[model samples]
Target chain A: MGVFTIAKTITGNLFSRPPTSRYPAEPAKRFDLTRGHLAFEPENCRVCRVCMLRCPTQAIVVDREKRTWECDHFRCITCGNCVELCPTDALHLEPAYRSPEADRPGKEFHEIPAPPPKAEAGGETAEA
Target chain B: MAYMKRSPWIIHYDGSSCNGCDIEVLACLTPLYDVERFGIINTGNPKHADIFVVTGSVNEQNREVIRNIYEQMPQPKVVAALGICACSGGVFRECYNVMGGMDKVIPVDVYVPGCPVRPEQIIDGVVKALGVLEEKRARMKAGAPAEVPA
Candidate 1:
């Protein structure tokens, strides 16, 4: 509406960075409680069932008979409740939000990590 | 019609999102899509808008503000609920504080459903909202908006 309004707008835009994010290709700036792929660090996992018990949607599944932990990412709410309640600090939110196989059709993407190579069963894995 | 076709304003609200959809909504307004080229403005004030774009499940803390904001918009407006969260509570349906989707709070005209709907989808939804406005204007001119049966 005013003569100087145009000038003010141009100056304000010059100070701001472009808004699009280049993720996966470049490391993202991390944030607190970032809702990302839930990383299950099995090294420290005690198989306590704490993450399983605290999850709201039952997205976290632990087969006590098999001694395995799983998460169906498509169903996860990313509430960080499991990480908060886990005593082992085994489950936590990762900085990388995008999942691999993002565009694949019909094949369920963002799968719960494959049950750690079963010691009793024969599968492709490392041995202790 | 001419004024609306020239400068369409939208108010984007995040009810109780995890912020994945929030970032994508912001991405649509950025250089990637450059929605501003279409003269679309994302405003914080609801009274100045002809469109409402909502993301996330309507939580207890935000349902009141969301409803009040929808009511404040001038007539002949459209609401495009973005992401699966706003569509039908997406993956957060049963949370203790979540009040389901924004639709449970206000009437939604168009729904763009995705985990976090892509920028192109967001643009398509906005364009659809504009089309709804044009259709409503035609109805008002033809007296079709009045005396309609339930």
Candidate 2:
């Protein structure tokens, strides 16, 4: 009992946490160069549907006639190809490595809606 | 040797990829990610591997090669598709050469989802496969399953 307990205790002290994993609490630690989710600015979208054509799973659906665009969060591959090809600088990648719920197959994840058009920054004045 | 057996070897196979996912997969093997501590070795051959990580959606050209590789792998093997492309035929959804995710052909044991799958995410899939390996080993030891893959 004396020897066994001591060895176990010492081993536990020697190696406790997995070095690479800092998960479920602090968020999966993102490396500086890591690419996360791609931000989509629908207003900047040209309706060219290039992103739709390039998506690996067709995760991004564009209905040009309806002027509606939404990304199914569940289906998004986070590949960043859309961000790379966006000519308007509307799409940018942000790293959020952790997907809170990965196993739910039928649930739909949605992107935030585009804000209404605003006055040009230079032309806008203080409201009365 | 005991540790080695516990830490089964895995091999990465790319049929066709845009390279986004491939880079992510390799990131796991790097120091920042450090997948090696888990005993996940990137082996060069199928016979030496317990896990075959197919990273890209299978295309018409690569489909035969993948199948042949799968056949050559020893028994008690598990196939893991490491990205959306390999999992659900991601960006190549409508591509003519790609039939679908790897599951369209192989019995995928675990599916890691990401544009190109995060290092931790891929680790999650590997952990799941390890569970399957444990179960199969237990069944074999109990003499309940004869054909269980090693």
Candidate 3:
């Protein structure tokens, strides 16, 4: 409101560091529990439909008979409900978000990986 | 292209939502994420906007409003659905008043999927929308019919 205020504002603008984050050019700093995206580890998945049922938006579609799991990216709210409800810890939240692409909606379908086989009698089981 | 490449004004509208994504959309304008560096200007009037950024879902009450806004914009405009709600209605899809995504009312050029949509993701979505805007301009120059989905 005064001439001194204007002079001070000019001096501060000249000396202060810019507050803007240089994202895209530099990596974004996501927090430890940031729910950016969801990951489905088919190897650890037991073809359970818990994630599908637990999803509030019904974004996940699990076909246990066909051993296929699919997620509609656009439809997912990234609420981590599926990740939290996964019994085998097959579904988890990733800190890295999905990059924006062309106008088309994305849906990912992944085949369930086979569970590790048991070792021969009296042998130690392979750890995942 | 030179003019559009330098400045692209945006219009932000909030439909049926919890207002979380709306705050993130506004965050992109703040100094920390400063989307203005890309020459994006947020405007309220749809006629002056080159990009339409929508947050939240399209409900029965707001469908007409969204359609009218999209209709007011000139050709070569892009629409960004800024969160899971705008993209596919989020947790409100099953609500009796909710009709679904922004796409249900108008063509959407980009989708940033998140609960509240991070500022970085919103900026990324806008960048992708800029590409679509270029394509729409080219198509308009070519005199091809704009085959936007109904």
Candidate 4:
């Protein structure tokens, strides 16, 4: 009886498809909530620097004067603090990781255009 | 040099990691991930390795050891920094003993950044490293000077 069970198990293993994921040939498994990487929308960014301040790794640098937002991908841990704290909803956590690179790439920089004068007025009114 | 692509042996070193990334690295070797399909074999000797897989952040204690292993590997090699810690010190960057990422000690060819890198990402990083190895070999074959470590 034991021998029959072992044979059945062996045949089951042999007939079943391999469990390994064909990652490169096919896409890797991803879910809706996966914190793969961070994405920034310069137009929506208020340059409040909240993401910069809240980031534990200090991976974000926002220059309000220059209206520039920069993120060092290497330093980012995908912790989502910036995503959660962005008052303007400028930041988002994407579900696909940044591709691997051969050389250390420079920081991701985006020059946010100055907010429209009317939007600035509205923002101040909302704050008040 | 051509054979390096067919079967690239990698040597892994833990600098000061918390072992989260290391576990993911191990997962890549399991049947589920099975990195061996790409001819990747994790080895123990640096001299036999074509790629260096480093996990964790570099600290004062492990810098020299990391350098020694890097020096032992033959030319036309590649280095893959396997996690956020190995890439840029992760959350430990501010620590007094932590000196930043793998590039601080040795030139890194591929940077894979994750708090604890996923097995799929590890395989992706290794594939990227293989591409780098091919480039280095081509450079060597042309008798060009190897890249100077920054």
The most accurate candidate by TM-score is: 4
Lowest lDDT 10-residue stretch of candidate 3 chain A:
A119-128
How does residue B37 of candidate 4 score in lDDT? Answer: 85
Q: In CAPRI terms, where does candidate 4 land?
A: medium
> Taking the tens digit of each residue's C-alpha lDDT, what string does model 1 give over B105-145?
78777776556766666766777778777776677788776
Q: Tell me the spans in candidate 1 whose CA falls farther than 4 Å from its real position.
A: A1-128, B1-6, B144-150
Candidate RMSDs in Å, in order, are 9.7, 9.6, 4.6, 2.9
- Model 2 global lDDT (CA atoms, 0 to 1): 0.68
Off by over 4 Å in 3: A1-13, A116-128, B1-4, B146-150
Question: Which one is best on lDDT?
Answer: 4
Per-prediction DockQ = 0.07, 0.18, 0.63, 0.70
> Can you write out model 2's per-residue Cα lDDT over B45-130, one digit (the tens) per residue?
98898888888888888888899888788767778777777777776768888888787777776767677677777777777776
User: What lDDT would each prediction earn against the true structure?
Assistant: 0.68, 0.68, 0.83, 0.86
Residue range B3-90, candidate 4, lDDT tens digits: 3357789999998999999998889999989888888999999999999999998999999999999999899789999888998888
True contacts reproduced, candidate 3? 0.74
- Where model 2 places Cα greater than 4 Å from the true spot, the runs are A1-27, A31-56, A60-74, A79-95, A98-106, A109-128, B1-5, B142-150
Native-referenced TM-scores of chain A, all candidate models: 0.62, 0.58, 0.80, 0.88
Per-residue lDDT tens digits of candidate 3, residues A1-128? 69999999999999998888888788997999988899888877876687887788899998866879999998887888777767678888889998775554689999986555651131121121
TM agreement with the true structure for every prediction: 0.54, 0.61, 0.88, 0.92
Evaluated against the true chain A, what TM-score does chain A of model 1 have? 0.62
What's the DockQ of model 1?
0.07
**Can you rank all candidates by TM-score, best first?**
4, 3, 2, 1
